[model samples]
Each structure stands twice: as structure tokens, then as C-alpha cells.
Target chain A: MSKQYLTTHTVDEAHPTEIFSVSPTPSSLFSASGSSALQIHSTTKGGFPLQQTITNAHRLGCHHVCTSRGGVGNVAASVGFGGEIKIWARQGSELLPQHEANGEWELRWEIAPTQTNGGDVWAVALSADESYLACTTSDGRIHVWDLTARERIQSYETGGSGTGGSFAMAVDLSRDGKLTATGHESGAVYVFNNNSGRLAYSLSGLAKSVRAVAFSPGCKRLAAAGDAGVIAIYDMERGEHVSNLSATSSRPAWITSLDWNDTGEYLLSGALDGKVKVWDVARGVCVATHSETEGALWSVRWLPKNERALEPGMGKGEMFCAAGANKSLTFYREATGI
Target chain B: MVRFPGQTVQETRKFEALFCILELAHEALLSGNLITLRNIYYQNMELFVSQAVVNVMIDSLASTLGVGRWDLNIGILLPSINSIEKIDFHSVKWVLVIEKEATFRTLAASQYHQTSKAGHGILITDANRLPLSQGARARLNSGSQRDRPTKRSRTDRGGDPVASITNKPFLQKAENRGVTSLQQSISTEYPEANHLGHEQRLEEELVHGVNENAISHHGAGDPVNSTMTLTQTDRKKVVSILNEICTGEGTVCTAVSMEQKQELQRMLVLNIKAEIQAVDHFGDITKWLDEKLCKW
Candidate 1:
């Protein structure tokens, strides 16, 4: 019921620019390189290093990347600046393209969002069962696609002009695929009730931009933050700011990215100043701060805990990974009580 | 407790000192000796503290002054005092500093004094200079970017004598309190405003005779000219540079070659000492350098 983590090792030379995105599979960790490519680093055991680099994954640099663990099947989705969304499958260290017919290594058609409002895709979140892929655009629009039918299923508007030169900062789908959460530049956090096909709630707390948002594992809570230097937590059902996580500094450093742990007990945040903080949700305090470089950190995530890997009758193991401004991916194992 | 990893020893000490000063100054300023409060502020600035605390103070003061601090874009000069490089200029408009002391000769040659005519920059150095009592507080009313543009009012005869605007009652009170605090120890009985005023009047008569230009006097071999007068813009610039240094902005890109690093270190000590000596109690840079940097 208790967990603590410290960065044990750092993969220093894995990326050229800051590692903006990170997704971990059972055998390897996938990262979107600063340049135009997707790289996979083997994290099977021991120490992990760059094992594969899929060059030309996109013409321009890739920004958002996501993966599903179970349900619909194990599938990965990545979005780049050129308005194309590409999906791939875990193939050891390299991602094999998932196609409808010929092979799972073929391109699955790139959707051009520029036609709708001339905005770029910023984030992608997969449903727990891998049946749905939800993405946010640069102009505060959320589009969902059903992976089973390979067709666009739903579209939701964030009700704000996202013209601050940044995309919709983040979007997340609930574990059961019943709710979709989105954060916008105007400091508005909107949640859509997927089953009802309507905007469920518009939450408020932050006055500056909202660069990151995440839904709690139970799907009842939402965390949002950005330039305000405070993380605002809202209740999904009530649509109210439940709690505010006060930041330590007053710099206009944006909270560029955020993620909730598998147990939803802690949250991870990356900032514009190349610093990452792990927050203890219950205590409302930053438990740890990581800063290896001076560049901006774009994203961070907790590795999915595997129950089977623990001893018989023991609990599941907790592990987390961080990637950002220094073009590197760092894996940290939860500290065990000695 | 959030731990900032790999914080340099010097940085940690400066941050600690800065936090202490900010917390203490906030409480002291509330007691209402405005002039003394401001002097206590300037005399306590360190390289790093300057960057971190100065801007915060500027912001706090701006709020008190009913001005938006961020909009006050100021210019600064940082001459590679000791081993320090660029003075942190986090939220400022411009910063001019030699990262290496070897450029000092070249800096002296340029018509630098003319460009900074309206007092647009503050110089930060480690070199020793004149006494603080002689330093001027002659703020140019029409100088700052936020100042209103008014028609030039003719003087009594020929040249326009810069007229004093509104008397800053708050600053005057603070200054009076500061002089009293320094000249006389805190008495057991709480000194009334009148008693403080009487003490201040006595000190002012003595201090008034000292011209602002007297503080610019250099004893001997001062590489950077001490006679270079600064405008309020220049002072704001110095504050910005200090803010940057305090916030770790100065160290962001400091992983230079080892050779350059050594030169930077020496220049910082020299320049910083020179600058601090120009102020008053802030001359205790020895404590920061000896206790912090030497340990590292």
C-alpha cells in the first residue's frame, strides 16, 4: 500500500533533442526522438540502451506517443507535427507498423487535421482495452477513433481558441473508456461523458494556461496545471476544483506534462525548466525533484506495474520512467524498505 | 521535502541566505522604517542573492508602488567579477558583461558613458571602490520607461536643473530609521517617531555635505573606471543581473572549457569584491566565498 522511488540510472545519450515522449512495453521502452524518428530502448533487465531507431517515422519531429496494455490488444499511437497519426505494435525493441491487411508493419493511413481547422495533433491516449484512440489537436479539439472498425467515432470541442502557438496540452481516456479528459491553453479542463456523448464538466482553478491533465485511475478525478505553477485537481462528477497543489516556485515555467501512477496514489510532472517532480497526492507535497539538464522537460510517465512479476502472495511491483529536455530516458525502480 | 539535485555548494548557500533575507526583510519592512529598509536591502545583496532576491524585491516593491514590475524592463552591466560569468538577467531587458576580464581594456575604450546618459544601466563588479554614505539616491523622475513624457520646463537661467518631484515620504522615513538604527543601538524603550526623526536630522546634516560624485573616487589602479556614473536604468539592470545569478540562470550554460572556467573564477572574485566594496555591509563577500566556494 506504500511506494517510494528514486532515479537509479539515466539513459544519457538515447536522444538528440529532449526526449518529449516515453511509452514502456514489457520488454522495451519506446521514445519519440527530438528529431524525426521513433526510438526503442531495451529495458528487459540489467541496464537498458538504445536498441532501435525507426528513421523517418514522421517527416517532422514527433510530439505525442501512447500505448495500450490490454483489452482491444497491445497497440501504440504516435502523432507528429505534420498532422499525421501513426500506430505501431511492439516488436522487441522496434515497433512494427500495424496495417489492416498486408502486415502489422505497414502504415495505417495518416489523417490530416489541417482541413478541419489547420491545427496539428498534440496528444494521443489509448483506452484500457486498446479499442479506442483519443487525440487532441493544436486548436483545442478532441477526436476519437474506434480501432476495431478503424474509423473516426466521435469529436468534441474544447470551447476555447488554442492559438498560443501550443497545441491542446493533454487529453486522457478513462480506464473503462467511459470518460475523456482534455486540458487547454486557456486554463480550462473539460471532461466528456463518452457514454452520454456530451460535455460532462468544465472545471476551473488555474488562471494561466493548462499544459497537462490526467484522469485518476478510478475516473472520478482530474489533475490540470501549466503556467500557473499550481496543479488543480477537480472532481469529475461534481465539476469542482477539489484541491490545489501549490507550486514551490513562482517562475512562469509551465508544467509541460503530467501522469498519474498505476495506483493513482502519486502524480508525476515535467516542467519547462528541465525539472520533474513526483507529487504525493494524499499529502499534497512534492516528494522528489529530478533535474539532470537545463533544457525543458516535455513528458514523464509511470511504467505499468506487473502483478505476476512479484513473489507468490506478494503485491505488484511499482516502477516509473522519465524522459525529457536532455534527450534521454531514465528508469527508476520503487525503493524497497530495507 | 523536494530536493533540488546537484545544487552547487555556492548555490545552496546563496539560496539559504536569500531565503533568510527575504523572510527577514518582509517582516522588517512591515515595522515601517522605509528608507532604512531600502538601504538594508541594497547592502545585503550577494552575487546569487542579487539575482534571486532583487527581482522578487522589485516585484514586491512594484506592487507597493502600484506598478507592474514585469513591465519595467531594465538594463545591467556584469563585468566578469572573479570567476562568475554572466550576471543572471532573468526578467530584464538587456545585460552587458564581459565573461572574461581580458576584455576590460576594450570596454574602457568605447564611448559607453554617453549611451547610458539617462542612467539606464547598473554596473555589477567585484572591485573595491568609494564609501557607501557618499552614494547618490538622485532618481531621474522622467527617465524610466514607465515615466510620463512631459514638455521640458525651462530652468531659472540657461541649463535645465533636474527638479525633484514628489518627496517619497515612505523612503524618507525608512532612511531616517536606518540612520538611527546604525548610529545608536536599539534602546530598551521603544523610540517614538519624533526621537527617530531627531536622530535622522543630526545624521542627515553630516551626510548631506558629502557629494554623490565623491563615491566614484578610486584609490589606485582601478581597471574599470570608477568615475562611470550610472542612471536609475543602470541600477535596475544591476538588479536584473543579480536576479538571474540567484535563480541558477547564470549557471545554465556555464559548462565551458576548464581554462575559461579558471579565468572566470578569478575575475568573479576580483569584480565581485570591487562591486560589494562599493556598497556597505555587503562587503562581507569573504564569508560567502570562503565558507561556500572554498568548501566546494
Candidate 2:
């Protein structure tokens, strides 16, 4: 049986241009768009009102933003199209300036200027504790920065320099902080072992550009999708191409973003065709599909389920948010008793 | 066991099993059902031992048949007709050379050719293969015997015996009709855009029809009871209430346009009407209103 989601709230004019990424903290939701500023909305209140707007967060425009799932849930990371990465921490309902280290509260890392030209940093992800940050470079390099030490600790290269290097488009740090995976333009998904600081698996299957790579919450499986219009799931332990999730009759459009819910039972995917689909992992079928606009969707995220929702008879309701060229933030709540 | 060249009992058993599997595949193809090498192996798992063994048998079968494995139509194969001459071309008005099987299937399933009444032919080729040779290129460019016009039989029309017999373009015209029918069949089998187009149409209909229905229903009802039946004063009151509830709570509520305000009011009334037994609260009303606005 399929699931249903009703749009709970929509900030139609949330951003002047396209909204690329939306990240949820414990109490707030952060949305980064083509504009230089990052907008924060309070999820605890009735209206989800805009709490703060950090102007000039990215001079050119911010494309990706992520919040740490572990730790204090106050730390967030954002990367802009101008090749700059900034970390922000929430302080009593107010977000402070970027990279302002106050008594070991923040770590400052200076990357070598020559290594990254403009537009090199495409995607970024933070470790569970916010102690490490993983970012993908245009030349297929995954750089792991030790946030506490404020230094570059490990660099995993997909290929040698020159013609062999493929552009790394997406990166994700596993919840356990043991594995780091990256999706590249060459349709290669590479998983690295953090403990050994070496490449663990160079997965092959999809022959099209990979736009999104995500590790399941349990870190047992990894999902990758892109121009191939199919989601490829790999068994992390055996590093084998396990199965594919795709429509039976007609294939979906290019998948741009992917996110797994906290329980890891459902996977949320957004595509260039403007459809956001909720995939039931165990059944290997798409349970719900929602398309509100014709414009391509750049990001989708599931809001963390609070303790109140854990109680029985609530139907284990799930909520997710999607944003893209429509310039609106749409929230979908799972329909109950349907 | 009768030994055939350097073979052991195990090797002979493997070969016999492969032969049996190949016979089953041949039967399936003849009945117009395609089977894959993997499917064949899985069906006879105990006999085949591994997928690699089945793959080798398939290649051997293809070589024995003097055709490519894909040409046998035993699976969802990529088109392997490398050169245009390799395609058994018939005289048609238009030729469509598709590099991908998926695309060809999509186009074939669409009603595009049938509606347009275009005489066309579709040829699938593997783009990774070598290009057409000079001789094959010349044949493709030059017209063949099938392209030539032919005279029609005199007794068929019964009106102009001499004219019908002298008609030079009869065969070419007949070929055109044949091509049209062929194209129609191909498209019917594969329709490319119908699935997506139907989905998009349904979605648009739901979104637009629901909003319109809510608005029209609001216009005909009492201003107070039906939320859509709001007067100018009522609209102002609702907007003010929304603003107060939204802005005061630290939520960023932008100044909604006139159309959006009406939509919110219509949704409020619909929700209220839908759940008439329950006591309505400002929070519930606002939440439902937000959901309605986002639905558009």
C-alpha cells in the first residue's frame, strides 16, 4: 500500500532564487538558496516563522547545507558555489558569525589556496559529532578535515591527477563515522574506511553521472542515484551491487538528491523531473510520490521525529521538506488513518 | 559416456545441461517470449553451476546460429546491427535509426506516428560498434528495386484499364502505406510519452480542479458560514488574524497576495465544513490553511 503526505506549510517566496538545500537541526530548519544569505525557521513554533537570516553567508551563492545529526544539534555546515565552506553554531536562538572560534567552541581550518580553485567544493557532510567535515572537490578528491584539530587529516583520491580524475559531485559521512562515500560524475561510487584512511570499495554499476550518495543510518547499505534514473543500492559489508530501485514501466528522471529517514526504513529522493518519492526499502517499491512544481528539485530532507511522535497510535508519522527552482519550502506530513 | 574431444564426465554433463537449456531458450524465442541468460541459469541452477557457464553457452549458441546473441532476441538486448546495411531495410518514406533500445521502445509506444500518418521505418543499431563500410553507405544512399514505382493491374479498378496498367508510381505508393502500418505497429508496442503525459495531466487536473471547485463553492455560499463566502470586511479580519498568529510567533509570514488570501479563506471553510462535529481551534485552522496554500 502507498503512503500519503499533506503539505503542512509553504513559504512560497522563501528565497528570491532557487532553494538548493534544506537542513534540519533539533529546533530549527536552515534553508540555503541561490541568494547569499541562509534563512533559518523555527520548527518548534506554530507557524515555523523565520528566526534569523545570516546575510552574506556565501558571496556568490550557497548550493549545499548540512546539519550535524549527533552532538548538540547546533552545528551546521554550508558550501557555496564560490568554493568556500562555512560552519555555523547556534547560540541561544541566535546564529553567530561564520568560523568565529570562541574558547574551543569552533575549529578553524585553512585549506591550501592552490589546491582548490573556484567551484571546486561541490558538496559537504559533517560527522555525527561535528568533529570531522568531509567535502568533495571537482577533481574527484574527498578531503576529510579534522574539525577539532583544524587541519586536513585525510585525502582520498578516486584516480590519479590529469585525465583520470573524475569530478566528485556528492559526499556523505556515515552516522557511525567509520565510512565516507562519494559519488562522482563518472558514475563511480567510492567508499573509504576512516580507520585505515584508504579506499575500501570502488563500486561499479551505474554508467551515468551520479548526483547523490547517501549511507543508511545503520551504515549497512549505501544508495546512489543520478543521470541513470535508477537508485543503485550496494551492500557495504560485501561491497556488492545488491539491487536497483526503479520504476517498472517508465524510468524516472535524473535524481538530484537523496536522504534516508532516521529509522532507515524509508528513503527520500528528489529528481530533476520535480518529483519527490518516498521509497520503502524493505519492499523495494516507491510508496509515495509528490510533485508540486515542474521545475527541478534540488534537495529533500526528512525532519527528525521528536519524542512525542514515538508514542504508539500516532502511526509513526513521517514528515519531509523539499525545495528547488520553485523558490518555496514545502513540508509534507504523513496522512493518518487513510 | 561418449567422449567428444578432450572432455571428462563432468565436462560432458555440463555440456549436456547447457544444450538442454539452449533448447528451452530456443522454444521460448519461437513462442515470442524473450528469456535472459541469467533467467536460464537461475531456472536450472543445479545443472548450470554458475552464471558464467550459462553466459558461455549463450555465446556458443549465438556463434552456431551465425547471428549475434542480441539478434536471437533472447533477452532485453542492446541493438547490435552496427551498420545501416546490416538492417533489413525496406522502402519507406522516412527512416529512424535509434541508437538506444529504450528510446526506440518509447517512440514505438507513442501515438505520434499514427496521428501524423507518416510512413516511417525504425532501425536499431549499437552505437559502440564500427561505422558503416563504403559499400554499405553507397547502398543506403542509392535507391533499390523496392524504391522503384510499378504498374498496377488493369482489372482491379474496372474504370481505366490502360491508365491503371501504365501507372508507374503504384508500387511506391503501396510501399508507403505498408511503411505507415509498420510504423503504427511499432509505436503501439512501445509508446514513449503516453505514460508520463498521462501522469502530468492527472496531476494538473487534480490541483487546478480542486482549487477551482473550492473557489466556486465559496462564491455561492453565505459569507460567514462558508469560508470562501468572505466579504471584504471578513477577508480583512481573517488576514489580520492570520498575520497576528503567524508574525507574532516568530514565523516569517510574508504579505500574501490577494489571490493567496482568498485561497486560504476557501481552505479554512472547506476544512471547517469537512469536520463539522469537532471544535475548531486557531492552530488547527492555520495549519490546514497552510496545507491548502502549499497544495497549489
Candidate 3:
């Protein structure tokens, strides 16, 4: 059965340039754009107020920013166009501040190639604990760094050699942190066994540049999407590509972002044409799709389950936000009959 | 398999071209920017080498998927086949004949065709391989056949490994148009890659289980970061050969791009920790690391 989502709130013109990525924590959403500053907004029931803005966070403008999905909203990672990565940690008192839903997260670790000599790191993801940061590079390599040790712990060369694979485009660590799945420019998706430190399975099917890859909350299913514009879902445990989710659009737009709901039931995907879709995993069909804006979308993410419990009538369903060329963070909520 | 810069020119060029294509497509898709193949070739001429090379690359990707080039948003470079039905050979300014292949290579590298002191000059190298060769001219004169994509046998419509496993109704409208073709060019182009494209998929199918031991750690904490650099022994600075290799080799393979590729080093992490534990026996660690690096 198809589901539905209503546009709840939108913070228009959130950034001066197009926002590249949007990551949501428990109580807040973090957005990074061409602008040097990173904006934090509260995911409250009514108005998704802009919470905190970190100015000069990325000197040459940020392209990717992600927060810990499974953590208590304490850690975050941002990658700037200048080939720099900075890890941010929330500070201040334990009590919730009056003006902010998510406390201020300060910059802690800076890996700037121009400064301390950082390598070329693109898309970054934080493990469940946010202790290990997994990043993808131009050359199809996935590196895992221990934030505490401040040393790179594990590096997975998806290229099958030392470092000669297709460009690893998108990456997502399973919530259990046992698996690291990367989607490459060649449209190949690989699932690495974090424990064995060996390639576990190289899932096939999608034969195009994969812009986004996501692991379900249960880590049982994985959904990947990109230039092909179709969402390919894989059986995570078996490492088999099980199905694909293509929107009703005749000419599918390149999908840029993907996120899973709390239950891993509905998969959310945002495409280049500014269409956001909610797919029913069991049915392998797009249950809900949003084409509210004509502009393209770069990032889409779901708020934690706790965010839904804010309103009584809303019921605990699902809430997701998408951003791209529109320069806005648009929030959508799954409609509940209650 | 650790292919550094200049290891194998062909494979590296293919990778370089594919990466540039995807990156351009990525940027264009995100901001709704429109770019053409001509623009891509000229803009990245230094990277792609030539326009014909770019056209071949795009054709391989687009035709294999059975999608319109426009779907990938790559436009044609306009073959510019305005062939003068008859050229006045008598009016030709000059004709330079180069017999040796070595001489041609050196001249081509210097772009002798355009840089030569002669004016209104057109250079044709390896004319037999050109589109208007003797066989093509005969067919064109007869007017029996127009332009059509030739079937290359190297990449046949073999049994689709992926199609065999899953039932994808998502693109059912496609009717499995080029399901087998998608795995043709991208994966098979790497000559040195013993098992990159098709064979790897079948291997993955045979291997089902994961490394359960790799799932030992179950630590979940507040996502935090520190200013600590590499491990230090109480202010006495220490650096390992592994650190240099990681950063140095990473820079070479990845080039100097804002796009960052990561190498998840759990394998290196395990070996390093094991070596640290057995520091009493130093030789054992080197041998062990050598074995691991070789396997990779």
C-alpha cells in the first residue's frame, strides 16, 4: 500500500548557495551548502526554526555535512570544497538550552590538506557510536578513522587493488557498525565485512553512477540510487540485490540522496529533478513521491523516531527533510489516520 | 592491484575519464546544469586526450544501458561529416608523408597537425581506421545503408547474472532492454583487472556468509572528536612507515581533487594492533604485514 507525506515546514533560502547535504540528529537537522557556514535547525512540530549557524565553519564553502544518526546528537562531520574535513562535537550543559533543541556542536578535529595535510576525502559517514568516521574518496576507496585515536583505523579499497577501483561515490555504515556499504561511480555496490576486514559481498544490478547509498535501521536492507534514477534495494544479510524502486516518472532523474525510516519499512529517495519518493520495501513500489519544487535535490534524510513523539495527534510515523538547488530545507511527515 | 599514476596508461585513462564523467554528471544533476559532450571533451581535453576518445567513452556507457544519450544528458559532438563530395587535389597546398610510426607518435604528441607552420592544413593519420575508409566509402556510394551501430562481438548479450537473481519490476517498462549490456564496457575495459567486471559478480554469488569475527566490537558512545594527532609515546614523537604509505599512496591514486576516496583499513588496523601486541618479536610483524599487503 502506498503511504503519504504532507509538507509540514520549509526554511526557504536557508543558505546563500545550493545546499549539498542535510543530516538530521534526534532533535535537530544540520545543513551544509556552498556557503562557508553550516546551519542547524530545530525539528519541532510546527515551525522548523533555524537553531544555530556555524559561520566560517568551512572557509571555501562546505559541500557535505552529516550528523550521527544513532547517537544522542553530539557528533557531526563536514567536508568542504577545499578538500578539508572537520569533526564537530556538541558542547555546553546537559540540560536542553532554551533557544536550541540541539546543543551547539564545536569543531574538534580538523583534517585540512592545506593545514595539517589531509588526504582527498569526499562523502563522510559516522558510525552508530560516531567513534569511527568512514569516508569515500575520488578513487573508489573507503577509509575508516577512529575519532578518538585520531588515526585512520581501517581503509577498504573497493577498487579491489591497493587503491585502483571506481570512484566510491556514496557510503553508509550499517547501524550495527559491522558492515560498510559503498556505492561506486561504476554503479557497483560493495558491502564490506568490518569485522573480517575483507570484502564481504559485491552486490550487482545497478549499472550507473550511484550518488547515494543507505542502510536501513535494522541493517537488513540497503537502498542505493544515483544517475540511473532507480532505487536498488539489496538483501543486506545475503548480500543479494533483491529489487529496484523506480518512480512513476517516465524519464527518471538521477537520485542524489537516500535515507531509511526508523523501522526500515519505507525507503526515502531524492532525485535530481527535486522529486522525493517514499518506497514501500515489501511491495517494491513508490508509495509516496513529492515534486513540490522544480529544482533538483542533493540530500534527503529522516529525523530520528523520537522527533515524531513531539506532537500527540501526529502519531509516531516518519519525518524526512530534503534540500538541493532550491536552497531550502523542506520537511515532510507521513500522514497518520489517527 | 594498487594502480598508481602511470602504472598502465590505458586503464588509468579509462578510470580518469569515467571519474570525470560521473563528477560532471554529478555536478550537473545537483544544480540542474546542462553540459554537452563537446564541452566536456574540450574542457577536459588535458584529461581525456581527444574528442574521439570522449565520444567512444560516452557511447560505451550510453549504448550499453540502452538509454538515450540525452538520458545521461550527454550530447553528441556533431561528427562534422560535411565531406566535400569531390576535393580539388590540384589546389592542395602541400602533402607531408611520414612513413615511420615512431615519428608519427612524437609529432602527434606535439599536436603537429595544428601547430605546423603550414596554413589550411588537414592531417589524416591511420586513414584505414577512419570512418570514411574504402569499405565505408563503397557502402556510402551505393546508398544502401545509412549510419547504424555496429555489433561488437567481444561484448555479447550474455546471460545477465544480475537478472538471473532478482526480479526487478521497477524498470519493467524497459523490458530488460540492455540488462546484460550495462556490465559490458565499464567493467571489462580494465585489461589488467583479472576479475573486475563480470567474473566478480559470479564469485560474490558463491560467497554468501560474512566474517562474523569482524563483528566483535559493539561500542556505542556519544559521537565525539579530539585534537590528538597520530599516536604519541608521551610527547616523544613517533611515526610509522604505515602512516607514510597510507597518505602518500592515497594522494597518488586519487590525484589532487576535492573528491575524497576512503580506504577502510580494518585489515591494516587488525595487523597493526596485532603487531603492537607482539612488539617483543619485531620481525614477525613485518612478515605479517607484508603478507597482508601482498594479498590486498
Cα lDDT tens digits for candidate 2, A1-338: 88888887788879876788888875567899766689987665556788888887775457788886543455778876446788776553234333322222131333442445322666889888777889887667888888667777888777775333577878899999999999987889999999999889999988867889999989999999976778999999999999899866354576878999988989999976678999998889999999998766889988887554232332445778899868899888898886
For the candidates in turn, chain A alone yields TM-scores of 0.85, 0.90, 0.92
Question: Per-residue CA lDDT of candidate 3, range A3-91, in tens?
Answer: 77898778889997678889988888899976669999877555777788999887556768987657667788998655678998777
Winning candidate number (TM-score): 3
Interface RMSD, all models, one decimal each?
Answer: 19.7, 18.6, 16.5
Local distance difference test values of all predictions, in order: 0.51, 0.60, 0.59
User: Taking the candidates in order, what DockQ does each have?
Assistant: 0.01, 0.01, 0.01
What is candidate 1's lDDT per residue for A1-338, written digit by digit as tens? 33466666678868655466887654456788435678876554556656667777765457677776332224668876455788775333223223211222334545565533544566788888666888887556788988768778898876544433324667888886889988766667788999888998888777656767888888777899876667888887788888978666543355777888877888888776667778888888888777766555667777666533433322234666777656777777667774
- How would you order the candidates by TM-score, starting with the best? 3, 2, 1
Label model 2 with its docking quality class.
Answer: incorrect
User: Deviation in angstroms for A255 in model 3?
Assistant: 0.7
For lDDT, the strongest prediction is 2
Instruction: Quote the lDDT for B76 in model 3.
Output: 43
Tens digit of per-residue lDDT, candidate 2, span B75-135: 5332222321222224333333322333333444553223223434333232222134443
Candidate 3 stretches greater than 4 Å from native = A92-102, A114-119, A307-317, B1-296
**What is the TM-score (0 to 1) of candidate 1?**
0.50
lDDT: worst 10-residue window of model 1 chain A: A96-105
